[model samples]
Target: MNVLLLNPDALRGSDPAYPLGLAHIATAAMKAGHAAEGVDLFSENCPETAIFSTIESFQPDVVGLSVRNIDNQCMRAPIFYLETAKNLVHTVRKRFYGPIVVGGAGYSIFPREALDYLRADYGIQGEGERAFVMLLEALEANSKAFSFPGLTRRTADRVEWIPNVPLASLEGVWADRSLFPPLPYLDAGTRQFPVNIQTRRGCPMECIYCTNPWLEGKTMRFRGPEDVVLEIRSLSDNFGIARLTFVDSLFNHPTSYTETLVDAFLKARLELSWECTYNPRFHDPHLLSKMHDAGCVRVSIGNESGSNLSLTALKKGFEREHIERSVLDAKALGLETVCFLLIGAPGETKDTVLESVCFLDELNPSSVVVTLGIRLYPGLELSSIAAKEGMIDPRQSLLSPAFYLPRELEGWAESFFLDEVLPSHPNWTV
Candidate 1:
């Protein structure tokens, strides 16, 4: 089977990501004795004609387009990426007869809505490692793939989803970091092409503002340290990969995982610089030291709110002290950090918003990304709160891109961050 993997992601919502999940699927399909090829719409400036040409040239038997993001992750703005996605789907619908399937992190979150919106024949949710290869096998046999794990299908009447897949063991597919294209660095102006290697999956923290607990099922699992080091070095040697972004929901989960992995990378002397997100609850001084020794340059901390009132409302287990200490420790150890501030969650008030500003004032990191809106997605604690407060439409699906700020707060929350929270830091922008 000739497989066409499309990474339809933009620079804002998603990085020029290496299409990690797509590559895994392509590799799996190829390993299963099928010819696989990939196309990334991220770097391309051309539109339909170019993609059509590429598809025409390749003439794939099956097409898999990876939708990495739904919105700009701000203002529910329909990203340009979606228009590109819809155009590709419609173009493929008219020109081609092969099956069109969708997969990726953002696609998994709203698989049914996205499939319906894009009018795709099928979609896969959760992990794509198993379902993608299985879909390929089914396509080769010219049979239905409805029974494939983590698959979703839309019929004339409604959208149907299969059972969620179990956590795939990372033994075979810990993300072949060699396949990723060169990506532009966010902080550094330098051009870097490194393969992304996700060492762990799923976070145990149950922040009310988060959907990870529901999406990832609160399981914190890490691949073996030796396996991770081997993959990183191979990627570096084969592809000249120098940087890595540990795509773990919370890379520092289980604390010991970070310590062990950091020690391994240092001892191996891989000379690889990696960035990741860390859980705020952990502020171990010793672990922070290990991170610096291991060549970790930056870590993103999800300090969702600066106010204790907001923190309590969001059910984030850690308080302001935990956040403060973690930032201090990371800075002390010479590790750069990016702080994430999510304002205007449910039960947000003026006082709580101020608390958040104060928190930001105190713990100014190297950089900060301020998010003005929140998602009222189904199965999340925030979704329930939105329902209780009548902030969301009862008929709309959570994936329909609803913004959950209180009606009273309106633009106040957005402007407050701009006027107050952001300017305090030397290098901050919304």
Candidate 2:
């Protein structure tokens, strides 16, 4: 079987993320005695023409499209990414008569809706390494037994979804970097783009608007510290990659594992600069100092809101004081700190927004990112709140981008951020 993996994400941003998930699936397919190829549309100048050309050239028996995001997550000017994905699927269908399977972080959230909207043959909801291989085997044998974790298929009447099960360990699992070359992604822009590496999976934190717990299960899984260090060394020696970004949900959680990983980096003596997102609840000065010493040049704090009222409503698990201490600690160690402020969540008001602005102003990190509204997905507490408040229909499909912003702050939030908050904070960006 010839398997072609396509990355349909073309979202413009500061960096072009290498499709690590697709590469993993491709690698799994190859190891299962199948010919696998990967094409990334993000680096292409014309994705439509490129999709047609790739189908003509590869003539794959099966096509797997990885959907990374549903929208830009910006409420002020939301770009629905699914339209591009659907068009890509249409192009593939026109050129090739093969199974089209969709999966990724974005598709996993709304499996049925995304599969129906994209009009794909099947969809894999969660981690695809194992499930994808099983799917390939089934397709090859022409077997109807499609029972597997995270597999979604369209029946004659309705779409059926099997719940996803998180992998218990990441011991021998590794992504095949050869599928997607590093130079094209690295040299896409003038700003240095870091290669991403995931040291762990799963998130236990229950933030109201977050989809991490849904995409990845609540259990925490860590790769071996030595294995992660070896991968970093390979990136440096083989690819000449110096910068890295750890894509873990919470890099510093379970402080013991983080300390061990840092120690392994020190022992390896690899010269690489890296950054990761940190949870303020696990703020520790000593561990942070060790991380800085271990080639961590920057840290991004996931402080959604600096006001206690909004923080509690979001179930952030930490308070404003924790954010302050984390930012100050990272700053003291000369680590570039970036703080995130998600405005217009539930319980957000004039006073709470002002409190957040004032708190961030006093802290003064290296940079601040402010978002106006929270993207609502189904089965979230915020979605229920939005429905109860008559903000959205309870039965509405969120495949199209829908945001949850308080009515009280609708006209006022955008103006306030533009006039008062953004004008004063030179380091902040919306």
Candidate 3:
């Protein structure tokens, strides 16, 4: 069987992320004795034509589309990406007559709904490396009643989703490097193409508006630290890429594991400068020092809110002091710190917002990202709160974003952030 993996993500406002997940699936498919190819639309100037040409050239038996993000996730100026995905699906269907399967972080968040919305024939939620291979084998056998985890089938009336997939072992899972975007970083000027690497999957933290726990189960699954080093080494040796960004929901959780990985990196002397999202709850200066010594240049702390009232309201489990100490420790080690502040969550008022801004001012992170409102996803506590407040229908397909912002804060939040907060703090961005 021949498979074509397509990455339809072209949002390049920030650093354009490579389709690492699709590459993993493509590699898995090839290792299973099937021919696989990938078409990355991220760097394409003409995506529609490129898709048509790829289909004409590859003529794959199955097409897998990886949807990385649903919306920009910015409540102020949200850009929904599913319409572009839908158009891409339509284009592919018009050109090719094979099955279309959807996967990736965005699709995994709303598998059934996304499959239906994109009008794809099937979808594999969660990890797709093993499940995708199983799906291909089942399809090759012309077997129906797909019983694999993460597999979903769509019919005329309804979409049937299989059980969520267990965490896949990273023993031999790797993305095909040859299919990656070309060098010189086209849109991202002067920014080194830091390859995105995932050392683990799943997040245990249950933020009120998060889909990580739902998309990837509450339990964390880690790849061997040695295996991670080997992957990084391979990418550096083969592709001349040294910079890496660990895309785990929270990379430095389980302090012991993180310290172990850091020690391994230092022992290997890989000369790889990497970064990751850090959980501020565990503020260990020793760990921060080790990370800096092991070539960690930056860390992003998604503290969400600096106000304890908002933090407790969001069930973040950490208070302002944790964030402050974490930032101070990282700065002491000369590591660039980026703190994420999400204002306008439940229990957020003008005073709480001010408290958060003042806290950020005191912490003095290298950079601060502020988002105005919480985008509510279905099946989350925020969704229920929105329902209780008559903000949205609980049963509504959140495929289209529905946000949870207090009525009183409306018209005030946006301007306050734009005019007052952002301008006052040179480091702040919305």
Best by TM-score: 2
CA error at residue 144 for candidate 2, angstroms? 2.2
- In model 2, how large is the Cα lDDT of residue 287? 95
**Candidate 2 per-residue lDDT over residues 71-132, each given as its tens digit:** 88889998888898998899888888979999999999999999988899999999998899
Model with the higher lDDT, candidate 2 or 3: 2
lDDT of 1: 0.74
Per-residue lDDT of model 3, residues 347-392, tens digit only:
7998888898888888899999887788888789899999998889
Distance from true location, Cα of 63 in model 2, Å: 0.6
TM-score for predicted model 2 compared with the true structure: 0.97
User: On residues 1-430, what C-alpha lDDT tens digit does candidate 1 reach at each position?
Assistant: 8887777646633445667777677767777788777666655666466568867898988888888767665663544356667777887776678889988777787878888988898898887777887877777888754476688888898988885665656666655433345443233455464446778777777787676765665776668899889878877776667888887787777887788888889889988787888777876778777887787888888778788878877888888988998888888888898887777766788777777766776787888776777866666777777777887766567665776787767878777767765566557767
Candidate 2 segments whose C-alpha is farther than 4 A from its true place: 188-191
What is the C-alpha local distance difference test score of each model? 0.74, 0.88, 0.84
When 1 and 3 are scored with TM-score, the better candidate is 3
- In model 1, the number of clashes is 2
Give residue 372's lDDT in candidate 1 (0 to 100): 71
Higher-ranked by lDDT: 1 or 3: 3
- Candidate 1, residue 25: how far the Cα is off, in Å: 1.8
- Candidate 1: residue pairs that collide: 182-193, 306-356
On lDDT, the candidate that comes out on top is 2
